[model samples]
Target: MDTATASKNPDTRSATDRGLPWAEIDTVLFDMDGTLLDLHFDNRYWRELIPDEYARLHAHEPELARQRLFAEMERIRGQLRWYCLDHWVRFTGLDLLALKVRLERHIALHPHALDVLDTLRVQGKRLVLVTNAHPEVYAFKHARTGLGNHLHRVVSAHALDCAKEEGCFWERLQTVERYDPQRSLLVDDNLAALASARAAGVEHLRGVRYPDSRGPAMQSVDFHLLESLAELLPDRRLHAYASSPV
Candidate 1:
């Protein structure tokens, strides 16, 4: 069934009122930090720890350091550089990679993310982890969480030199991944990335309701909402393949 038809079906409701045409989807693209993994680590590192570290390193007042860092973060908010650890190190004069390594304990997968991934894999769906994380950051997180075992491939925006917020990122991704937009589903925590994907002609899109485990749930206006990836699991009793523990 097409998405339009599935949307109109009253019986389609499950995790959300706007049910997806799961049967028609072949490729499932997932965002890394927020969608499949807990976003609290990233949020805490950037919002709290970075400011504190910057203050300590530069001998600036904590509040002042936060203000300065926040301004720089805002300046590159949706750009690829915002997600690049090397760019951040160069811009802030902070050893971000080292700091991330120090805080690797915070990196973790969201509940049931593995179950959903395993189910999709068992069902013969092409799974790709698409993230705006820098190559260095991706490596750090992947090493800590070992999420790579569950995915067919992982694509970082660093490789494309474009953030997922830009439609050109999707265009460039298509050249490399060669996914049929209509038959693919993208689950992301960022609305901007979803908008870009939609504009790039991707037919199926879903947004995470609660990206950060420590934060309140967000309402998604433009795409279907999911409380968790577990909602997409084919069977609640299905056991995921064993992998390196997070």
Candidate 2:
């Protein structure tokens, strides 16, 4: 069926169709860390580097320090404090911002991420990055990768004073970005965040199954998955988009 015909009549499409109605969607809300950039850098930073640094700085045994840190992290997994670098600096007495900058070489974008961003831009979609990463973290990654250049706007959940996993985040986000939930799509790796967006009336959502290249691809029980952003744009002309610098 023709694109126009299929877009107009949903009944005409096959049951197995995984295609999104781009004509119906105007705003695309993206999660920065895992959705656009590789999540391995974060996993390693929090799980390995921070623990080692904490042990070194506080004179605690390495294993015990990691264990203590993991427990604290689990305690606030979905809360705003979990994603706050300042909170960690105070909790661990370590200069986390400096450490993050030191490990800047590890930061990177996921496969086909640039192509997807450029394609969405060409489609005239209002791309907004809605991330839980602290502004400092986002600022560094933005400077490193120029991901912000392709986006129309970037909204950190920190600005909204809540984590994306919180149900209120979507509503609070609307105050800064007037995106229609019915005509918007949110792409994130966190299932909890996706659930919160759904609860806030977002009609479309997508999850990245392979946010951490080093880890096994994950499965989402509640949402369709994209192993790579390439799945979002299948146009053969995307080769041109991919060649464009971020």
Candidate 3:
């Protein structure tokens, strides 16, 4: 799926119909933040709350405070201890998760992302949400999106007890959901997460860059960049079932 197909027309190629040549990816593994859900909340959590707290603690300019904190956080983003928000809070003496939640309260879903999931389910594709969010944050996101009822299962990287950067995290995912990797497709906004899945042998993976992002765009995954899930739905032929009335 090219960027053109993202807003132009449906590819008319279901994972199998495209002659994907894999075992038939009946299972579609979806990432929550930035993939299905918009990254606005997470971005705000870091860009706002973290900075405000840092300024309060250090008595510095908010921008300088945030930049300093972000610099430190980025240095260890892929580290095991970093994924554990509590661990970071303990290490920094700041309530990381609590601060994150304050910002997360404003998160929302990308246009038509959930509609694609509904179409997938209606098409008989097994749906599973694979994310790195902790249980509390996960609940907040799901409730806000009204998507919990549309999925078959939700698996978090935390549940796997590891960060998605690790190969073992992908390997462990196999145990939670019995899906053929060759046939399975993983979608995420994080390049590392996509690479980890590809390394685990899931062939039809995609990375959706935030449409208006100013950060490092994820290009490590295959080039199927989608800005909206509406791109995957069938045309008027299945419009009624695939999307909300326009």
Judging by lDDT against the true structure, name the best candidate: 2
TM-score of each: 0.87, 0.88, 0.79
| Reference-based lDDT, each prediction | 0.80, 0.82, 0.69
For candidate 3, give the lDDT of residue 130. 87
Query: Tens digit of lDDT per residue, candidate 2, span 1-246?
Result: 111111222242244435678888999999988789988899888878898898887574767877788899999999999999889988899988788876788899886787788888888899999999999989989899999998999999899999999998999998999999999999999999999999999998899877887777778667887645665773654544333333
Off by over 4 Å in 3: 1-23, 60-68, 96-101, 211-222, 234-236, 239-246
> Global lDDT for candidate 2?
0.82
User: What is the TM-score (0 to 1) of candidate 2?
Assistant: 0.88
Off by over 4 Å in 1: 1-18, 60-62, 235-246
lDDT value, residue 101 of candidate 1? 67
lDDT of 3: 0.69
Q: Residue 213 error for model 2, in Å?
A: 1.3
Name the weakest run of 10 consecutive residues (lDDT summed) in model 2.
Answer: 1-10
Candidate closest to the true structure, highest TM-score: 2
